[model samples]
Target: MSTLSTSLFYGGLGILVVGLLLPGWDTATLPRRAVKRRIYWGATLVALPVLFAAGWPDVQSSLAFTAMACVLMGGWAYFRTPNIKVGGRIITADPSHREPDPTPRGGGRP
Candidate 1:
């Protein structure tokens, strides 16, 4: 991987770590969840180009790897994050949906 791609990969990895940890840092801070979710998505967004750049030697292989990475990461995110509700139903963290909840409701104490 080129220096740029490597940097991006590491940066993305760092963001992913932060995103994964944010929720544990605080439960009451909705902003933290938002930030974590943003970081996770941002890392995935950055990964696309980096994956292309990193795997440029073989376009097809690179694309495949990129797609796989996206799917796996997305799947992981979808099953991991707490407070994630799907299809109007609440689902606990399942190591599958790590992605932040998409809905924007319920940020304060009930």
Candidate 2:
């Protein structure tokens, strides 16, 4: 193996170690969100070594795809969940729910 590939492989392994050693709050309890986070992060870390080992092209494509996916998902989620202020509290407004009047006294001016 070339020196660059060797370094990348080792570097990926190092990242994997760092990821695994990092403390995760509430992960031990196996909550749904925690497990999902771990799975996604773990997969990314593991993919680093494999992509690095595979060569630069694979790494480039993988990174581009990941970045694109993140941006698209972020924008989609941002628009999909619209937040509404109700009685001084911010809450997500569901499609089936109607927002209450913001004016004081059920429609009177504040």
User: Which candidate has the highest TM-score of all?
Assistant: 1
In candidate 2, what are the lDDT values of residues 1-110, reduced to their tens digit?
Answer: 56776566556555544544454333333433233335446645564545445355566754654454445434432344322334644344355323332333333332
Model 1 deviation from native, Cα RMSD in Å: 5.7
Worst 10 residues of 1 by lDDT: 23-32
lDDT of 1 at 28: 49
Off by over 4 Å in 1: 1-30, 82-110
> Where is model 2 more than 4 Å wrong at Cα?
26-50, 53-110
What C-alpha lDDT, on a 0 to 100 scale, does residue 62 get in candidate 2? Answer: 47
TM-score of 2: 0.32
Q: How many clashing pairs per prediction, in order?
A: 13, 0
Q: lDDT of candidate 1 vs native?
A: 0.57
lDDT of 2 at 52: 49
Q: Quick one: best lDDT, which candidate?
A: 1
